[model samples]
Every structure is written in C-alpha cells, then in structure tokens.
Target: MTKHIARVLAAVLLSIWAYGAHAGDVIRSFNADILVREDGVLDVTETIKVNADGTDIQHGIYRDFPQYVTTPDGTRYKVSFEILSVTRNGEDEPWEATDTDLGTKIRIGDQFQLVSTGNHTYQIRYLTDRQIIFGDASDRLRWNVTGDEWSFPILSASAHVILSSGAQPFEPIAFTGSRGRKLADAVATVSGRGATFETTHALDPFEGLTIMVQFPKGAVAPPTTAQLSDWWWRDNLGWVVLIYGFAAVFAYMMFTWLWFGRDPKAGTIVPRWDLPMGISPALMSYIFDGMNRPGFTGDL
Candidate 1:
C-alpha cells in the first residue's frame, strides 16, 4: 500500500511538470513591413518567431487580417485580402486562406505534421486594399501590425510603414496594449518616405501593436468604383449571382404582366340603366360586373 501511494504522488508531479513546460511558450518576435502604393494597395509582409513547446502551437500559427470596416456614419466598406505566399524558416510552408467572421485567416503549417519544439519563424506575404483612409487634407493609415488575439505574450514587436517613392509621411504614432487603450507604449520615427515603430516594453497576452501614419493629400488615391466592384464580385460571387438571378426573374414577370396580362381600359364607363338591344340583364351583369354572382359564365 505504501509503494502504491508513493508511485501515485510521483505520477501527479510529473504531469504537472509537463504541463508547465508547454504553457510557458511565448512569441519572441513579430515584425511587419507595409508598403503603401499610389494606387491604394498595400503590400504587407510579416515575420513572426514563436517559441513553441508543442501545446497550442502544434501545427503552426494562424494570422488574421481584417477585410471590412464600418464608418461612423453607418457605412460599411470592403478591404480586400490577397495572399501572395508563406514560408517557414526560409522554405515554403503549406498553408491555406479562409474567410472567417473576424477576417481573412491564413492557417500556416500542415495539418498532418506537428511543429518541432523550440523557436520557429514564419513569414507571410499578402496584399490588401482600402487600408488607407483618404481625407481632405491627409490620407491616414491605421494598421494593427500584430493583431491582439494572440494567446501568448509578445516579447518584442515592430513595424515599418513605407510609402511610394518621392512621397513623404507625417504624424507617425503607435499604441500598445489592449484594443482601444490609446496608451503610448512604442516609439515612432519618420525617415524619408517611411515610418518605423518599435515597442518600448514587452506586450502581454491579448495586447497588440498599432501604427498610424499620415501622408499629404493626393499621395494615396482612393479606390475607384471599378476596383471596388471587382473585389466585391470576387469575394461574393455566389451571392451576387443568386441575387441577380432573382432580380432578372422578377423583372421578366413584371414586364409580362404589364404588356400582356393587364385588362383593357374599361370602355369609358358610360352611365346607362337600360340593357343593350340584344344583351340580356344577366349577360350584362356577368360581362361588366365580376363573376361572383350565381350562374355567371363571364370568367369562362
């Protein structure tokens, strides 16, 4: 009995030790490079390094980039997310892109494989549109470089926002902490047509890094209607086709009703009490009035 109790206690302690090792995994580095194009497209690349211990980081990491935003005036617009490539540790890694309620989720790593325990680096390249908010005086870009949904603490994070050639940027700012905290925890600097941000302290779990930069008017153009429509159709092809099919059907039915199904104008409604020379009273009632009365054959 004594030996059994000792063994049981030893097993419990071993389980606790194993759990602690995996629970302490952390994100060592997160770096984002964003380029603002003159035609309103943003090319972004992210390099993320994680210290994995085979817990939640089993397969690999998933990055989320939002695809829409609602303005203060209750208008919602689309932001397109087009993935270019993904690599892990200098080699191409298998990945897939999916649309979720949150945004475009790029799931990196093969489902059949498990990531080795230790530090692993992932590089993701993607293109996005409508990330710039064009204003009358300035065009502003507010980007969440490292999203706030990570389950682990970020030891270090940074971002660099670069503009097109010959265009200067201004008012570079960065915020760190939970969403909407506004507490400044990073330093921002402007060099030439680019702005850089680096965190002053390590970010806790659920905390993120957001950067903003402003450009002079006409530096970044607003997306044209053709571009917007193209994205809309690509993202929602099935729904758009279904809606248009229903609309076409309704239009055809309405046209047929107006052209061929409607009755002729009621003969000017001459007021006369006497019946016609050859028409009987019952026949007149059945023809002029509806066929609701008994023995009415006008409908046939």
Candidate 2:
C-alpha cells in the first residue's frame, strides 16, 4: 500500500537525520601539558578545540579521567583528581565534576544555555596524584594523553611532559590506537628535562594517544602516609557519611530519653485544698460566672 511505503520512507529519513547530528561534531585538536612537581603531584593543562555542530552539541562537552589503575600483581590504586579551572574561549565557563563508574567526568556547559555551532576552544587546568610509579633505577610516568572513548574523532593530538631541572629523562615511548592496543603510530621525543609526543595520523573515535617517560630515581617523592589516608577517605566518603548520620541520630535519641522520658523521682505527698486564695469553688463560680446559675447560687 502507498501508506505503508510512505511510513517506511519516513522512518529511513529520521534515522539518517539522527546519525547526521552526531557525525558532524569533531575534535579539531587536543593538546596537553603536564608538569611533574617534586611533591608527587602533577599539574596538567589541556587545551581542546572542538568543532561542534548545533544539532548534538548544544550544551557542551565532557571530559573523563580514569580512576583506578591495577599493577601486574593485581594491586589496585585510586587516582586523585582535582580541577583547578575550566575556561572556554578565554573566559570562565560553567562546569560540574562528578564521579562516574568509568572515572571523573568534568561536564562543561550550562543546561540552560546553548553553545553556537562552530569552533570553540576549551582549556582545563587540573591537578592529579598517584600517576607516577617509583622504581629503584627510575621513576615512570605513563599517561594517556588523549583519553579513549570520545564519541567524536580527533584530527590531531599532542602532549608535553616537563620535569624539574637537572633531572634526566630517557626511554620515552608513545602508543596510538584504541584501548589495549599497542599500535606504534606516534613519535616520542625527549629533551633536557621534558618529553614530547605527537600522533602521526588522525585518531578515529575510540582511539587515543598514550605516552611514557622514565626519569632518574628520586626525582619526585612518593606519596606520604597522610596523602594515602586522604585518598582512602575520598574513595570511601559515602560510607563514612552514612555511619556518622546513624550515630548522630542514635545519640540524640539516647539523650532525649535520659533528660525527658525517664520516670520522675519519688516524693512525699502533701494534700491541701485551700483554693490558694481561701475561696470555695461554689462562691468563686457564683461571683465570677453568674448569680443566676442553677446550683452555684444555691450552694453559695
């Protein structure tokens, strides 16, 4: 029937339009600069250029940072991430950070606002700890420069890792591919106390660039005990709040019962009926109520 054929055509047109909305947005460039401080913290700045189409990218973009890392021995460690600032086109932008199952997601944009279609530049400055591995001979910084799982393709990506002065860095390596792939399609270069990496070709969606740099031992201090405790509390704060709330409620109930709900102390009884002013109820009511009362006047 003609009606049935028309419905099929409408369905096909709708699917095509939906796909086009997402397919038009792309990452023009992604650049990251990492500064390895001597106090075991890494200060990073990422400048991301996005070419968004109005259809799907009306709000803004979100960046995700992975949370946990497991060693060969199966020991898992949580990485600490703190956002310093986020700017769009050289001005402050509204953003929110939340912990997701994948990691930390920094969502930038206002729900009530819409970003115009075209190129927009975003700069994110943040601090992260527990990203370095200390070894006997050297310390290692293996970081995923451009995180995988982006829905849009990236045309170019690069990173620069800077260490302190007088520190020697060697054995620089770079990998480019999807997660868990070792495709060596990138170049890593080491200078005096820094390492730089760049991808050789464009990265499709779900592809990323990971770089590594090894420096002399003791270049950066290991995390202290206090830092470890802080990270632990950060990871388990939900449980801590829950327990604290229950304890507070229980303490309040116990205090209220002790102060107000207990039985009164036993005392000797002294009975007296003086009406306080030495006036009988019948006379008081006859005077105060009405002299024409049925029984109050007679009793008085």
Candidate 3:
C-alpha cells in the first residue's frame, strides 16, 4: 500500500511538470502590413514567428476586430472581416475559422503538428470592410494589432500601413495607444503616403496595441464635374481678366487711329528733292535744253 501511494504521487508530479513545460511557447517576432483602399476596404497581411517548447501538441491563433465603429459625428459604419489565406513556412496550411461574438477564432493543429524546438513562421492574410471611415471633413482609421491578444508574449512587433490610389498629396497623422501601461517607447514614422509603427520590447498579454491614422478631407473623393469647373474658373480668373483688359485697350487704340489721329496729307505725294536756291537765266536755259534731249523728249 505504501509503494502504490508513492507511485501515484510521482505520476501526478510528472504530469504537472509536463503541463508547465508545454505552456512555455513564446512569440519571437510579429509583422503586419495593412493596405487601405479608396473603396473603404482594408487588406492585411500578418507574419508571426513563434518558438515552441516542444511540449504542446498544436497551436491556435485568434484575431479580433470591432463589429462596428462610430465616428465623432454620430455616424456608424459596419465592419466585416474575411480570411484570405494562411501559410506556414511558405507552404499553404489548413486552418479552421469560426466567427465569434468577440471576433475570429482560427485553429491550426491536428494535421500539421506545431511542436518543434526551433522557430516556425506563419503568414495570415485577410480583408476587412469599412475599417476606414470617410467623414465630411476627414478620413480616419483605428486598427488594433493581434500581438497583445496572443497567448504568448511578443518580443518585437511592427506594422506598415499603405494608402492605396486616390489618397495622394494628403498628410497622414498616426499614433499608438496601449491598454494597461504607457508605451512611450513606440516609434512611428510617416513618409510620403505611408506610415510605419514599431515596438522593440516585449508586449505583455492584454496590453492592447492600436494605431490611429487620419487623412484630410477630399483625399479619397474624386472631383465632380461641377467642382472641376468651379476650380478651373477660380484658378484662371486672373488670366482671363488680364486678357480681356488687353483686348479692350488694343481696340481703343485702333479706333482712335482710324477716326481722329490720321495725318492730313497722308494721301498726297511729295517731291523727293527741291531745286537749287538760285540759278542764272542762262544756266537754267542750258539745263532745260539738256533735259529736253533724246529720251527726255519722248513724254512731251
């Protein structure tokens, strides 16, 4: 009876040790790329590097997003999510996804064992609608990273956001928010039309990670015909006024010249040269006699 009790106690202790060892899985790194389009759609691609402790049999991944978001103007937009694809180590992997009240629950385990000594990379791609809200004055996006919601701790995490066509020349403002503690060490950069945010230190569970970006109004709205015409007239009004003023001045000058500014003797011909001041009668007679010779006498 003593030996049996000792054996049972040993087995219970070993099971507890095994369970503790299996719970040691940790995330090495996480990266997310979010693309925002003009049609109010968001395409997200996530890459996660996880290190398993070689004890757990499988791994499960979950992602969540708000079902609806309300803007400052009391406008509400419905949010929807669709999973695109899932891959592990560059190969496609099968996953089971279910919609829950909180968000989405994804399970990848049975067929492909995730228990390994080294690191394994998993890439998840998905699409969401109405993630960006277009307001009358500005467009805004509020995105949350799955790093803080994961089961294990994340060592490093980064997110890159790209605005698709139609949102050019608009400045973007981005900032980060944490759930529990203040993460003052988060770094964010805005270049051209894209923004990038990164965190170097570990992210504890439930310490929410979120990014907010705001774009100026009219960035995604194309100009209507009336708007284009109004802009054209507004921009070229100065040139048009100057041209009409010049035309009026030229017409006035031409009218004056034709009506009251002409020369009085303009139609009459004038002699090219005047005769000599004085000449003797004999010299004048000789000059006239010489001019009245040969070819000069034909007209007479």
Return the top candidate by TM-score. 1
- Candidate 2 per-residue lDDT over residues 14-72, each given as its tens digit: 88975564468888899999999998788999999998887557899989899888889
Rank order by TM-score, top first? 1, 2, 3
Candidate 3 has an lDDT of 0.67
Better of 2 and 3 by lDDT: 2
Candidate 3 TM-score versus the reference: 0.57
Residue pairs clashing, model 2: none
Candidate 2 similarity to native, TM-score: 0.71
Task: Judging by lDDT against the true structure, name the best candidate.
Answer: 2
Model 3 agreement with the true structure over 173-236: per-residue lDDT tens digits: 3333344345554577777777777775566555545666777765555445875576456546
Query: lDDT, candidate 1, residue 109?
Result: 96
Per-candidate TM-score against the hidden true structure: 0.72, 0.71, 0.57
CA shift of 211, model 3, Å:
0.9
How well is each residue in 164-261 modelled by candidate 1, as lDDT tens digits?
74588999999999877876889999998789999987788889999998899888777689987887776678788999999999999999999999
Q: Model 3 Cα RMSD, Å?
A: 22.4
Candidate 1, which segments miss by more than 4 Å at Cα?
1-23, 228-243, 248-300
Against the reference, the lDDT scores of all candidates come to: 0.86, 0.87, 0.67
| Winner of 2 and 3 under TM-score | 2
